[model samples]
Structures are given as structure tokens and as C-alpha cells.
Target: MSEDLEFDCGGNRGDGRLIYTVTQISYEIKLILEDSYPTVWILGEISNFKLYNSGHIYFNIKDKNTQIRVVIFQSASINLTFSPKDGMKVLICGRVSSYPKRGDYQVIVNRMERCGSGELYEAYGELKERLKAEGFFDESAKKPIPDIVNKIGIVTSQDGAALCDILKVIDSLNANIETLIYPVRVQGKEAEKEIPQAIEYFNSNHKDLDVLLVGRGGGSVEDLWAFNMESVARAIFASEIPVVSCIGHEVDFTIADFVADMRAPTPSAAAEMVLRSRNDIKKRIEFLRESLNGAINFILYDRSVELDKLILSRALTKPYLIYEDKISYLDELDNRLLKSIGSLFKSKSENLGNVSHRLDIVSPLSVLRRGFSICFDSNNEVIEDSKDVNVGDDISIRFASGSLNAKVKSCE
Candidate 1:
């Protein structure tokens, strides 16, 4: 399809040339630029970087000669690990689009990143260091993966290829394991909260889970930034159940990987590890059953041989022999008992005599019988000093066995 251009050459009628209004020219140029370049990745230095109140980011990507305006809406920009700054060298990927009002072409940025020195990687390293200092990555704190996992929780996007890979492995193994799928955003800003929330939910409420498989498929550093979040690492560390991190490719590692109980190279690898040989469990059980049968037979044979010997022994075959030995043993025991009883009685008698002697020495009646008498006032209180008695006071004299009442006639 083709449209004719109405030529208005400088407002004078019809010189055979295509001269269009400013608006028409701008529209044609915009359509040509947009339709020609569907998408582009531009390398340039950031200048006049601005994040608007409307949550849209505006910036210009420029090299030596010219610059192009760039805009990344909130949805894409929110996933940025590091804040974009002016004078920062960056690589931006977007489509070329024109603003009709200004008639200016700009790149509608879909993604942005620092070019040479990746700010996202630096931020990842910093977060890793911080978590390491906090002992989130300490091997000592890591829980051990159960040798036999019966139930496991999966925290990942339900529809992700990684989940499909994991489920395939698990299903193939025929592992009789209960699986609880906790679907979450695997990438982007929402993933930061969603991933950690799933981990916390499993830890707080799902105590019965044998293990947790937390991860997603491989992606760029920014795309996998959620797994590197501090909250996610803390949640993994806080889990009472063991967590196996299967994040990204074999080469990629996240904070969650370090803090997790175990790290699987991939999601399928994680699934394989969680249930090591479930499909072969029947074979193992059969082998064990044979082993037990053999052991029991061996044990029974040995026991029968011993029983034969015991039955043939003198104790059973010649019953009176046992009774004869037992009779002798009883006599010996009787003599020993008699001697022990006599020795015990002698020792007890000696101990009692010693105790009685000590008691006699400490007895108050012993001192009184040694010819001392106690005097009491009229109130019958013991009078130990002469000052305790007065001339008009009645007194009582107490001997060892008896007491007599007396009236105090003189002071002396």
C-alpha cells in the first residue's frame, strides 16, 4: 500500500516537488525511524539523568558527536540493581520511538546496565560482603540436607522451565516425596519480596517439610538479583528445614546459594540430589531383605548348636549333679552368712559402746551427780550469779534428782 504526498512547495502552487508541512514531515520521519529500527542496543555515556516523580526515568545516551534521549518506564527500571547516574558509561537496549509533540526521536529504554564496570556486579559484591560479615554465609550455620527426604517445598516460579526440569527429574525417579509448590517471581523487583516471603512461609508454617528447593533458571545478573537480596539470604538462613539453592547456571552464584544448606548446580540437579535413589528403593529393599534372612538363619543355626550343647551338659543330663553342687554352695553360703552376721553384730556393739561413752561425758546429769547443785529464784529461773538474788526473794535449790523451796533470810 502506498500513499501520495501532497506537494505544497513553499505555499506557491505546484512546483513538482514533495514539500510537506512541519507536522507531516515530522510524522513521516518518525515512522521511518521507528519502522526501520525495531530495536537497538546503544553504548554511550549517561548525561542529564533524571528520575521523574511519575516513576519514569529520563536520560540521554551520547557518544562524541550526538546524543539520543532515553526513557525507561518504572516497570523496567525498578529491576535495576544500581541507581543510574550522570556521566556513568552504560549500554542501553530499547526501541527508537518519536514524541509527536516535540517531533524528537528517543530510545524507549527496556533495559540498561553499566558497560565496562558493571554497577550491578559491584552492588552484588558489596551485598555479599555485608552478608558474609553477618555470618549468613558461614558454613557452620548451614543445615545439613537430609539423606532421605520425604517431603520438600519448592520456591520458584510455577511455570518456569527450571520447575519443569525439576519436576521431570523427580517424576522420573518415582520418589514418593510430597511436593509443595510455592510460586513466586523468579526475576525482577517483585521477586525480591516474593522469594523471601515464600521462604519465610515454609519456615514459619511448614515445619513438616524435609527440605526446601529454592531457585530458578539462569539469567543475567540483574535478572537474578532477587536471589542476591539480603532478605532472601536471611530467610534461607532462618529456615529450620534444610534449603538447597539451585539458582542460575553452574557458573552463577547468589547470596541464597551461600546461605543455603546445600547448593545444587541446577534445578534438575537439585531434584536428583533431594531424592537420591527412590526409583531403585525397591531393589535396595529386596537386597536388605535377603541380607536379613541370611543373618537370621545364621543366628538361628548358632543358637540351635548352643542349645544342643546346653541340653547335653551335666546340668540337664545329670540333674542330681546340679543339686549336689547347689547343696554344697548352700552350706558355704550359710557359714559365710553366719560369720558375716557375727562380725556385723560385734562392729555394731563396739560403735554403740563408743557412742554411749561420748554421750556420758557430755550428759548434764553427770555434772550434777559430781556434787554440784543449782539454785533458782522465786520465779524458778536459774540463779547463776549472786546478783540474781535479793534479800526478800524466795529461792529454790535443785539437786540432780529433786528440788527444795527456800526463803532468802539474809543477803549472804
Candidate 2:
């Protein structure tokens, strides 16, 4: 198939030579536009901003009278200093080129930035997001401010009104906190470096400092830009001592404020925040003293009541009652002892009588008293049977009254 051809200057040329296709024509135009304006800076307000899944951003820069399409490819979008929104005024730098497929010319932006205060504001937001992602602004990372602040280290210009204002407020509140100043520029090219250095120095050298006040007097965002720097933010984050940020008026916010342990609306407010008022402290002390007195008085009164009870005790009141009780107890014990002894003797006497009656039942002497006599042979052994005696044997007869000698005659 043959494609349709057109020529830019075709009326002449005799032999009909300068013929070109639509694609060739579009490429020619694209080259001309790109060469004419290799790079240009344009100022306009963004009307339509669309970020695609392909990582390219499509948008329109519009004025009341006209508008132009702009595309930021992935490479340029990755370097964007801020997240751009519709209606935001911006100054873009890019080269104009035509798309051959659509046969349309547009600006291919290489770099984009916000204009005026928008620039600083955009950087601020970007940094805030980045640091937040890094956990620098986390509550868990922040050190807790002590309830009682004794010494404060200030990082600000010594001559600045911020320092003066802070001192005045501290004096007005009658705070017991003492201050140590580490003078540094609050705004300038050197401020970013000096501020971080000051923070580090104080942290390393002053171990007793309870808190740090970092801020400057009220000014524009540019004037307060030093506090927004990454160095200052990281320095505040790394500090072991609790940092109190008071970078501007109540309405202004900075990166340093987010990274600090505490944030106050103004420098004066920071001073008062770090320490309690002397009047409040005095009231606390007074309350403690009164409580201590109450506790001691209670103890003393209880002990006094106990002493009164002891003084009126029965043993202490009559004294002689002690001896009387003891003597009564001793007499009762003696009577019990005597009764026990007499009972023991009566019991033993009855036992002896019984034993004597038993002995009379079994005693040979009792038999003898009944007129029975025991006969003993020459060997002095008692003869129980008549066969034990001989006719002419001499023997002894044992009577109950007396034993007598006799000669045995006959068994009968």
C-alpha cells in the first residue's frame, strides 16, 4: 500500500522532488520546535495534575487566555522537590517538542518547582514527610521533659529579641530554672551549620542541662528557614537533652518543632513551659510541710493516749495490790501442798493394813498360835511326816512361844 504524501514548498521544483509523508512532516516540525527553544522557563498556574500508574505525570499550565499540555516522565518526576497540586503557581523548565503519533506539540518538563513562598512551603512539606517516614518526628523518639527544669541551654543569637523575650517571661513567671546561652545565627547561610553544631556541643559538654530552648524571633518563612533545614532537624532528634522548640509565632511551624521533645508557640512560652512557676512550687512545698506536721502530730497524740492508759493501769494505781495478789497466790499454793501430803500418808496407812492381813493368812507363826508345832530333825530341817523321825533320835520342836529339845519315842 502507498501512503499519502505532502510537501512544505511543492508548487515548483520542476521535477516534483520535496515530497514527504505525514510522519516525516511531523518529525520535521518536532525538530524545528526543539531546536528553536532548547530549554525555557515558564511561569503559570497548574490547572490539571494527573499522576499515572506508569510513573509519568500529565498536567496543564494555564492562564486566563491560554493553556498548554505538559508531561513529566518518570525520570523527572522522581526528582520533584514537592508534590504539586492544582491551582498552585509554578515555574517549570523544559523543552518544547511534538508527539509524532498525535501530531501535537507540547512541553516536556525536565524540572518543576513552586514559585515564591510556595517553593519554601513545598520544601517544608517534603522534608516533613521524609523525616516523618524516617521516624525522627515520632513521639516514641522524643525525650520526656523533666517536671522540674533546673538548667536550660538556649541556641539563638545572644542579641536577638527572642533571647530577651524568653528571659523576660522566665523572670515574670518567677521560675527557678537557670539558663545557659549558646549564641548562634537564627537565619542565614551559616545558621544551618552553626545551629546543629551548637546543639551537639551542648549535648556533649553539658551533662547537667535539663532542657534546651531552640528558636528565633518571629519572621517570614525565609527568615525562619534555618530551623527547617535537615541538619537542624537531625541535630534536635539526636540530642539526649530534651529540646523545646519555639521557632516563630503561634501560627508558624518548622521541622525543628516537630523533631523537638516539646514545642511552644513562642520563645517566651518555651521558657515558661520548661519550668513551673515559683508560686506554684511554693504552694506545693507548703502543702507538703502541712502534711508532714499533721502526720507527726497524729503520732504524738496516739502515743500520749497510750501513756495515759498506762498511767491509770490497776497495777500502777495501787502498787500494794501487786504484792497482795502475789501473797494470796502463794498461800493457796501452800494449802494445796499440805492437803496433797496428808492424802498421801492416809493412802499409805491403808495399804500397810491390807498387807498385814495378807501376811497373817500365809504366815506359819499364825498356824503355830493355833497350837500346831513344827518338829525339826538334828539337821534343823522341819519334819513333816512320821517316817522322817527315828525312835531314839533327838530333835527340836518349834512352838509358837518357844522351841524345845526332845527325843522321838514312836511314830504314834
Query: Least lDDT summed over 10 consecutive residues: which range in candidate 1?
Result: 1-10
For candidate 2, write residues 300-336 as lDDT tens digits. Answer: 9999999999999987899899999999999999999
Q: Give the residue spans of candidate 2 off by over 4 A.
A: 1-117, 173-178, 277-282, 295-412
Off by over 4 Å in 1: 1-115, 277-285, 294-412
Per-residue lDDT of candidate 1, residues 249-357 (tens digit) = 7756678888999999899999998788554566789999999999999999999999999999998899999899999999999999999999999999999999999
Best by lDDT: 2
Score candidate 1 by TM-score against the native: 0.44
| Model 1: residue 95 alpha-carbon error in angstroms | 38
Candidate no. 2 TM-score: 0.46
Question: TM-score for all predictions?
Answer: 0.44, 0.46
